[model samples]
Target chain A: MAVLFGGVACLALAGGVGVIASRRPVHSVLALLLVLGSLAVDYLLLDAQFIAVLQLIIYAGAIVVLFVFVIMLLHARSGEVARVPAVLPPAAAIPVCAVFGLMLLVVLTGAAIAPAAVGPAFGTVQEVGRALFSRFLLPFEAASIVLLIGMIGAVVLGKRLPPSPPDAGRPAEGPGEGRSKRRVELR
Target chain B: MSTADLVLVGPELVLTIAAVVVLLQDAWATGGVLEPQTPRPAAVWGSLAAVGLALVWDVGGRRWGPAFGGMYVRDQFTMIADLAALAAAGLGILLSSAYLPRVRLPAGEYHALLLLATVGAMVMAASGSLITLFLGLEILSFSLYVLAAIARRSRRSLEAGLKYLLLGAFATAFFAYGIALIFGATGSIDLREIGAARPSRLLGAGIALLTVGLAFEGALVPFHAWAPDVYEGAPLPVTAFMSVVAKVGAFAGLLRVFPLALAHLAGVWGPMLAAIAVVTMILGNLAALFQTNLKRLLAYSGIAHAGYLMIGVAAGGPAGTWSVLFYLLVYVAMNLGAFGVLLLLARQGMEADRVEDLAGLSGRAPWAAAALVLFLVSLAGLPLTAGFIAKLYLFRAALGAHQPVPALVGVLTSVVSVYYYLRVASAALSGGAPQAVAVLRNRLVGAALVLATAGVLWLGLFPAGFTAAVQQAARQAAAAVR
Candidate 1:
C-alpha cells in the first residue's frame, strides 16, 4: 500500500511539473486537471474521500474551467512567444529542476513506513457533514461569508454606471460657444 | 453547542444576513438604481449594521469553546483578532465613504465585500483544524481576488488581480497537497491530533511543505513576490485592507499550525524558518531603498515586517506566541494608519503613493504628516512608539526561548530598517514647496487618520494593557494547537 501511494505521488508530481512546463495553454490546463484528479485519487487512497472529491470538484472542474475560459477570452494561445529566450529558460529551468530533484530526493529518503492499522475513520459523507457543521462550524460560516462577498462583488462590478450628475442643470455649451456667440453679436 | 457559541458567531451571522439582503437588493434594483451614479444610503447603512454586529459579537464572546463538534473554536484570541480585522474593515469603509465619491465608486458592493472578507479573517483567526483552515483561506483569497481588481476600468488593477489569483491558487494547491499528506500520515485532519502524534519522516516532509505554503500566504520570503505588485495594483482602500487584515489572518493560521500541529518536527522546520527570516528581512529592506513608488515601498516594508513576525514564530513557546500576537496588534494599527494616509493623499487617478509626492506634506497637511510620522516611527521600532514596544516584547520572547540566533538577527534587521522608515518621514517633511501641491483634507479621511493614529499611539504608550490581553489570547491560541 505504501509503495502504491508513493507511486501515485510520483506520478502526480511528474504530471504537475509537466503541466507547469508545457507551452500549450490547453494542454497545460488538461495537465493541471490530470494532476488534480490524480491527487484526488491519492487522497482517496489515503482515506480522505471527501477531500478527494473536493479536489476534483473545486480544483479540476471549477478552477481549471475558469482558467481555460479566461485563456480563451484573452486569446493567449500557446506557441506565440511561448518559450522564453535562451538566457531566461535555462535560468528558470535549472533552479526548477534542482528544486524538483531535491523534493524527490527528500521523499525517496524519507520514511514511507506504513502505520500499524487504519481505523474505520470518518471517511464517509455523513461523517464529513457532521465534522463540517459541528467542529468546523466557524470556517463553514466563513465560507458562506466568502460566497456572499463574491456574489456582492459580482453584482457591484456588473452594475452599470449612473448617468453624469444630470448635466449639473447647465445649458449645453459647445467648444468656445460663449466667446463665439459674443463675437458673432459684435460682428 | 451553547447559546454563547451562537452569540460568539452573532457578528458573522449578522454579516451573512446583510450579504443576503444586499444581494437581494442588487437583484431587484438593477441597472440605474444600484448603479454607481445613484448612491444607496440604505445599502451603506446595512453594511454598517453588519459591521456593528460583528464587533458586538467579537466583544460579547469573551471565553473559548468548541463549536460544530471540534472543527471551530472561539476564544479571546479569536475575539481580539476578529476585533482587529473588523476595526480595519470598518475604517476601510469609512475611508471609502469619501474616497469612492471622489473616485466615482459609489457602489455598495465594496462595503459588502469588505464585510465578507472580515468574516473570513475572523474564521481564519478562530480555525482549529486543517479543514477549517483551508476553508477560511479560500474565503479570504477568493474575495481578495475580486477586491484587488475592483476598479475594472484600470488595466493595472486587472493585471494585479490576475497575478494574485493565479499565484494564490497555485499556493493553495501546494497547501492542499500538504494537508493530504499529513492526513495520510496521521489518518486524522484535526490539528490537536496531529500535534500530539509522534513525528515521522513523512510527517516532517508534510510539515515542511505546509510551512512553505503557509509562508507564501503569509507573504514571507521567496513567496513574497506577489505582495508588492498586488498591493501596488489594487485600489488604496483595498490595499489597506489586504495589508493589515490579510497579514493578521495568515499569521493567526500559522501560529495555530506550526507551533501546534507540527511541534514534533521543529528541528526540521525551525532552522528553515530562521534562514527564510534572515533572507526576507535583508532583501525586503534593501529593495525598499530603491523603490520610487510609495505603494511598492510599503509593500517591501510589509515583507520586512513579515520577517520580524516570523522571528516570534521561530521562538514558538508561550512567550513567542504572545509576543507575536502583541506585534500583530501593533502591526494592524501602524499599517492601517499608513494606508489610511495613502488613501487620503491619493486623489482620483493620481496615486500619491510615490515617495516624492509626499514631499512638503508636513507643510501642506500637518495633521496627516504627523500621523504618517507616528506610523513610520512605529514601523522603525523607534522608542516611544508601538513598534518599539512590539519589537522589545518579541525579542524578550525570543530570548526567553533561548533562540538567540533569530533574536540577534531580528535586532540587526530592526536597526537596518530604521533608515528606510526615516527616509520616508524626512521626505514627508522636506523639499517640495507647500504652495505647489494640494493636500488631501477630506473629512472622512481626517476621521480615519485620527482613529488610526490614536490606535497606534495608544498601543505604543499603554502596551501593558494590550500585552495582557494578548497574553490571554496567546494562552488560548497555544492551547487550541495543543
Candidate 2:
C-alpha cells in the first residue's frame, strides 16, 4: 500500500512539474491530465472511490478536454513569445522562492496533525451531498453566482467585435486581437 | 433554508434577480449585436430601481439575526454597509448612464456587473462565517475585474484588468491559506467559533496573512502598488464605483474579523494594525502629492482614507465600529461625488483624467467646478463637511482606546492631504485658460451630484440623528460577539 502511494505521488509531482515546464501548450494540457489522473488513482488507493471517480470524470476528462479545445481554438503556436512581462527577475525570485519553501518546511514540520475519526458514511456520495445541501449550502449556492459571473466575463471579454466601419479610424483593441493575429500567422 | 433565511438575504436576492433581468433585457434589446448609438435607458433605470428596491429591503425588512446555519448575518453592521454599498452602486450607475453610449459600452453588461458587484459587497459585509466571507470577497473581486476591463477598446483598461486580476488572485490565495490555517488551529471556520478557541502561533500567522489580504483590498500602503495604475487605467465610472465599494467591503470584513470576532486577542493585532495605519496614512498622502492625474491622486487619497478607517478598526470597541461605519457612509458620498465631477468631463471615447483637464473649469462649467470644490474640501476633512466629522469620530475612537500616536499621525497626515486636495480644487476654481474639455450635460449625473452633496452636508451639519442611530447599532453588534 505504501509503495503504491509513493509511486502515484511521484507521478503526480512529475506531471505537475511537466505542466509548468513544457514548451508546447498541448503538452502542458497532457501533463495536467497526467497529474489529475494520478491524483485520482491516489484517491482510489485511499478508498475514496466516489471522489476518485468524480476527479477522473470532472477534471481529467471534461476540464482537460476543454483546455485542449481552447488551445486549438486560439491556434496557440508552440514558439509564441511570452508577451506579459515577468514580474520578478529570476535572481530575486529564486531567493524569494527558497525562503518561502523553507518557511513552509518549518511550519509543516512543527505542526502536529491529529486526524479525526470519521463515521461509516465518510467519503460516500450521499454524505458529501448531504453536507453540500445542508451545512455548506450558502457557499454552494454562492459558487453558482461565481460560475455565472465567470461565464458572463468570458463572453464580455472574449467575444469578437463586429467588423469595424471604414471610417472608424483605429479599431478598438479587444481581447480577440491576439487571437486573430495568431490565426493569421497560422494561415 | 427557511423563509426567514431568504428574508435575511433579501437585498442580495433582489439585486441578483435584477442583474439577471437586466442581462436578459439587454440581450433582447440589442439582439446580442452591437447597434446604433442610442444608450439604453432601460438598463440604467432598471439598475437604479433594483438598487433602490434593495435599499428598501435592507432598511424596511430589518430582520436582524444569523441565517444559513450561522453563515450569514443581517444586523446593524450589515445594514450600514449595505446602505453605503447601495449608495455607491446607485450613484455609480447614474454616473455611468451618459458615458456608456458615448463610449459604446453595452449598458446592460455594465449595469449587470455593477449590480452583481454591489451584491458581493453586501454579502461580504453580512458574512458570518469565514467561508461566506471568502465567497463574498471572490464574488466582489470577480465582477469588478470584468467591469474594470469592460471598455475593451482601451488597451489601458485591459492592462488594468489583467494587473488587478493577477495581484488580486495572489491576495486571495493568501487569504484562503490563512483561512485554512485558522480552521486548522481552531477546528472551525465560523468567526464566533474561532473567537472562542484559544489563540496559538498558527492562529496568529493566519490572522496576519488575513490582514494582508484585507489590506490589499482596502488599498492600504505596502499592499497598494496596483491601486494607482488600475484607478488611472480603468474606465472613470468603474474607478469611481470600485473606489468606494472595495473599501466598504474590505473595512466591513476587517470590522468583523478584528473587532467583533477576535476582540479578545486585540493585544496581538492592535499595535500591528496601528503601525500599518500610520504608514498607510503617511505614504498614501505623500504619494498623492506627486500625482498629476486626478484618478491616481484620488486613488492615493483613498489609501490615506483607508489608514484613517484602520485607526477605528485597531481601536476595537463600539466607538471604533460605529465610527468606521459612519466614516464609510461619508466616504461613499465624498469619493463618488469627486469621481462624478470627473465623469462629466468624459467625451467621445476619451476621459479628461488629468489634473490639467480641470483647469479653467470655473469658467466653462461653474456648477461642476463648484461641486468639485465641495467634494475635494470634504475629502480634505474641512469643517462643514462630512469628512471632518468622520475623521473626528475616528480620531476620538483612537484616543478613547488609548492610541494617541495613530490619532496624532492621522491629524498630521490630514494636514498634508489638504495641500494636494486643494491643489485640484484651486485648479478648477482659478487656473489659466480653461482647456476645451467638453463637459457632458447629462441630468442623471447632475442629480447624482446633488444627492451626494446633500448627503455630505446632512451628515456633517446635522449628524446627531445618524450618529445616535449608528451608536446604538454599534453597541448591538459589539454585544453579539460577547
Candidate 3:
C-alpha cells in the first residue's frame, strides 16, 4: 500500500511539473489532467471512494474539458505566449518559490500527527450524506449560494453589451466601450 | 430544518429571495438581453425593500442562539455586524439608484449582487463554525468581484476586478489552508470546540494565516496593494458599498475569531496583531496624504480605520469587541457619506474623483459641501462627529487591555490623518475657478446623504444610548464565548 501511494505521489508530482513546463496550452491542460487523475487515485487508495469519484468527475472530467474548450475558442497558439510582462522575473520568482517550499517543508515535517480513530463507515457515502444534511447543513446551503453567485457573475461579466440606442445620450466613449465595439466589428 | 432555525436566518432568506426576484424581474424586463439606456427602478426599489425587511427581521426578531446544529449563532455580535452590513446595503442602494442609470449599468444585477453580499457578511458574523465562515467569506468576495467589474464598459473597472479576483483568490487559499491547519491541530472545526482544545504551534500558524486573509479583505497595510487602484477604478457606489461592507465582514470575523473563539490564546496573537495595527495606522495615513483622487484617498482612510478597529480586536475584551462593533456602525455612515458625496458629483458617465473636482464646491452647493466637510471631519476623528467617538472607544479599549503603544499610534495617526482629510475638505470649501462639475440632483441621493449625516451626528453627539446598548451586547457576546 505504501509503495502504491509513493508511486502515485511521484506521478502526481511529475504531472504537476509538466503542467508548468509544457509550452503548448493544450499540452499544459493534458498535464493538469494527469495530475488530477493521480490525485483521484490517491484519494481512492485512502478509502475515500466518494471523494475520489468526485475528484475525477468534477476536476478531471468537467473542469478540464471546460479549460480545453476555452483554449480552443481562444485559438491560443504556442508562439502567441503571454504578451503581458511577467509579474515577477525569474530571479525574484525562483528564490521566493524556494523559500516558500522550505518553509512549508519545515512546518509539515515538524508537526506531530496523531491520527484519530475512525468508525467503520468512515468516508462512506451514507455517512458523508448524513453529515452534510445534519451537522454541515448550513455550509452546504451556503456553498449553493456561492455557486449561484458564480453563475450570476459569469453571465454579468461575460455577456456582450447590446448596441446602444442612438438617443441614449452617453457623453463619452469609455475604455471598455471602444474595445467591445471593436470585438463586435471583428465578429 | 426546523421553523426555529428558519426564523434565525430570516434576514438572509429574505435577501436571497429578493436577489432572485430582482434577477428574474430584470431578465423579464429586458427580454433576456441587457438593453442599453434602460433604467430599472423596480429592481432598485425591490432591493431597498428587501434590505428594510431584513433589517426589521434582524432587529425585531426575538429568536437568538445557536441554530443549524451550532453552525450559526444569532447573538448580539451577529446583530451588530448585521446592522452595519444592512445599513451599508440600504445606503448603497440609495446611492446606486441615481448612479446606475447614469453609468448605464444594469440595475437588476447591481442591486441583486449587493443584497447577496450583505447576506454573505451577515452569514460570516453569525457563523459558529469555520466552514460557515469560509463559505460566507467566499460569497461576499465573489459578489463584490462581479460588482466591481459590473461596469463592463470601463476598462479600468475590468482591470480592477481581475486584480481583485486574482489576489483575493490567493488570500482565500491562505484562509482555507489555515482552516485545515486549525482543524488538524484541534481535531475539530467548531469554534467552541477548537477554543477548548490545546493550543499548539500549528494553531498559531493557522491563526496567523487566517489573520492574513481577513486583513487582506480589511485592506490592512502590506496586504493593501489593491485598494487604492481598485477603489479608483471601480464605480463610485461600488467603492462606497465595498468599503463599508468588506470592513464590516472582515472585522466582524476578526472579532469573532480572535476575541471570542480563541480568547484563551490572546497572549499568543494579541501582540502580533498590535504590531500590525501600529504599522497599518501609520502607513495607511501616510499613503492617504499623497492620493489626489477622492476614491483612492478614502480607500487609504478605510485602511487606517481598519488598523484602529484591529486595536479593539487585539485588546480582546468586552470593551474591545463592542468598540469594534460601534466603530463599524459609525463607519457605515462616515465612509459611505464621503463616497456618497463623490457619487452625487459624478456627471454624464464621468467620475468627479479628483481632489480638484470639489474646487469651489462650498460656493456652488453649500449643503453638499457642508455634508462633505462633516463626513471628512468625522473620518478624521474630529470632535462633534461619530468618527471621534468611534476612535475614542477603540483607543480606550486598547488602553484598557494595557496595550498602550497601539493606542498611542492610533492617536498620533489620527493627527496625521487630519491633514489629508482637511485637505479634501478645504478643496471643497475654498473658492476657485467655476467648475463644470454638477451635483446630480437626485432625491434618493439627497435622502441618503441626510440619513448618513444624521447618523454621524446622532452617534457622535448622543453616543450614550448606542454605546450603552453596544456595551450590553458586548457583555452578552463575551459571556457566550466564556
Candidate 4:
C-alpha cells in the first residue's frame, strides 16, 4: 500500500510540474490530462468510485477534448517567442510562494486528528445513489437546472447572423454601430 | 425525491417546466426554415401563469420545514423573499411585453430566460446548503447573462452581458472557494451546521470570501465596478429585473447564512461588514450624485440600497433579518416602477436612459412623470412612502442589533441620496421642450406600473397591516434561524 501510494503521488507531482514546464501548449494540455487521469485514480483508491468515473468522463474526456479543440481552433504553434515560460519570474513567484506557504500552515494546523474508517459502502455507487436520491435531491435537481441553463445560454449567445445586403444597414449605423452587425470569423 | 419533499420545491419545479416550455414553444414558433411569426400570446400568458402560480405557492399556507435532507427549505424568510423576486419577474415580463418589440428582441426567449432567472433567484433564496446557494446563483447569473445580450443588434447590450458574465464568474469563484474553506472547517455544507462551527482561521477566511461573493451580487461598493456599465448597457427591463431580483436573492442567502450559520463568528465579522456598509452607502450615493444616465444613476442608487440591506445583516438578529425582507419588498416596487417608466421613452426610438431625455417629461407624459417622481421620492426615503418606512425599520433594526455606527451611516446616506433622487425628479419635471415621444401603450405595462404605485402608497399610508404581516414572518424567520 505504501509503495502504491508513493508511486502514484510521485507520478501526479511530476505531471503537475510537467504541465507548466512544457514549452508547447499542446504538451502542457497533455500533461494536464495526465494529472487529471491520475487524480481519478487517487479517487478510486479512496473508494470514491462514482467520483472517479465522473473524473474520467467529465474532466479527462470532455474538458480535455474542449481544450484540444480550442488549441486547434487557435492554430497554436510552438515557436521560440510563442513558447510559454517554463518558470515564473521572482516577482510572480513571491505571491505564488506566499500562497503555498499559507496553505501549508493551514493544512498543518487544521489537519484532522483522526479520520474514522468507514465501510466500503461509504463511496460506493449504491450508497451515493441512495443519498443523492433522498437527502441530496434538491441540489441534484438544481445542478440539472444549472446545466440546462448552460446549454441554453451557449446556444443563444453563439448563434450567428447572415450579414446579407450589408449596404441596407448603412443608414442605421450610428457612432460605434459597426459592431452591431455580426461578422463570422472562420467563414 | 419523495412526493412530500417535492411539495416543498413545487414552485421551483413549476417554474422550471414553464421556462422550458416557453423556450421550446418560442423556438418552434419563431425560429425555423420559414418566415418568423411574432412569439405567440399563449407563450407569454403561459409563462405569466407559471409565475403567478409560483407566487401563490410561495406565499401559500403550507407547512414549512426542511426538505431534500435540509439542503432546501420552505420557510417564512424564503417565502417572503420569493414573493418579492416573483413580483419583480412579473413586472419585468409586463415591461418586456411592450419594450421587447421596440428594442427588436424576441419575446419567447426573453420571457423564458426571465422565468428561469426567477427560478434561480427563488432557489438561492430558499437554499439551506452552500452548494444549493452556489448552484442557484449560477442559474440566476447565467440566465441574466443571456437576457442582457438578447438585444442581438445592440453592442451596448452585448458588452453589458460580457461584463456581467466575467465579473459574476470571478465572484462565484470566490464564493466556491469560501464554501470549500467552510466545509473544510466544519465538515458540513449546511449553513445551520456552519453556524455551530468553532472559530478558526479556516472559518474566518471562508466567511470573508463568502461576504465578498455576496457583496458582488448585492453591488456593494469596491465590488461594484460592474453595476454602472451593465445597468447603462442592458435593456431597461432587464436592468430593472437584475437590479431588484439579484439583490433579493443574494441578500436572502446572506440573511439566512450570516445571521444563523456565521452568527457565532459575528463578533469578528460583524464589524467588518458594518464598515463595508458604511463605505458602500457613502460611495454609492456620491457616485449617483453626478450620473446623467438614468439607469446608471439607478445602478449607483442600487449599491447604496445594498449598503442599507447589509446593515440588516450586520445588525445580526431577528429584527435585522425582517427589516431586510421589508426593505427588499419595498425596493422591488419602487425600483421596478422607476425602470418601467423609462421604458415609456422607448416609443421614441430612443432609450430613455439619459437625464436629458427625461426633461419636460411632466408636460409630455404627466402620469409617467408623476410615477417617476413617486418612485424617486420613495427611493430617497421621504416621509409617507414605502422607502421611508423600509429605511426607518432598517435603521431601527441596525440600532437594535447594536450596530449604531452603521445605523448612523445609513441615516446620513439617505440624506445624501435624496439629492440625486430629487435631481432625477427635477430633470423630469423642470422646463424643456414639451414635445412628447408617443409612449407605447401596453395593458400589462400600464397594469404593472399601477400595481407598483399602489403597493408603494398603500404600504406607506397603511403600515399597520403590512407591519403585522412582517412581524409574523419575522417570528417564523427567528424560529427557522434558531
Clashing pairs in 2: none
lDDT of 2 by residue, B1-482 (tens): 89999999999999999999999999898887543257898899999999999999998887799999999989988998999999999999998887777767877788888999998898899989999999889889999999888877666778789999999998999899899888878889999999998877677767877888888999998799999888877888899999999999999999999999998998888898999999999999999999987888999999999999999999988899999999999999999999999888843335777787788888888988888899999999999999999999999999998999999999999999999999999888887644456777899999999999999999999999889878988888888878
Retained native contacts per candidate, as fractions? 0.37, 0.28, 0.43, 0.34
The candidate maximizing DockQ is 3
**How do these models rank on TM-score, best leading?**
3, 2, 4, 1
Model 1 stretches with alpha carbons more than 4 Å out: A1-90, A115-187, B1-4, B23-35, B38-44, B263-267, B432-436, B480-482
Model 1 chain B weakest lDDT span, ten residues long: B30-39
Ranking by lDDT: 2, 3, 4, 1
Q: What is the C-alpha lDDT of each candidate?
A: 0.74, 0.87, 0.86, 0.81
Regions of candidate 4 where Cα sits further than 4 Å from its true position:
A1-28, A76-117, A164-187, B32-39, B434-438
Q: What is the interface RMSD of candidate 4, in Å?
A: 4.8
Clashing pairs in 3: none
lDDT of 1 by residue, B340-437 (tens): 87666653235566677788888877888889999999998999999999999888876776677777888887888888888989999998743434
Report how far residue B352 has shifted in candidate 3, in Å. Answer: 0.5
> Model 3 - which docking category?
acceptable
| Model 4 quality (TM-score) | 0.90
**Deviation (Å) of B167 in candidate 2:** 1.7
Which prediction has more favorable DockQ, 2 or 4? 4
Please write out the lDDT profile of model 4 over residues B365-458, one tens digit for every residue.
7998899999999999999999999999989988887889998888888998999899889988997843544555678888889999998998
Residue range B271-340, candidate 3, lDDT tens digits: 9999989999998999899997777789899889989989999998889999999999999999999888
Between prediction 3 and prediction 4, the one with superior DockQ is 3
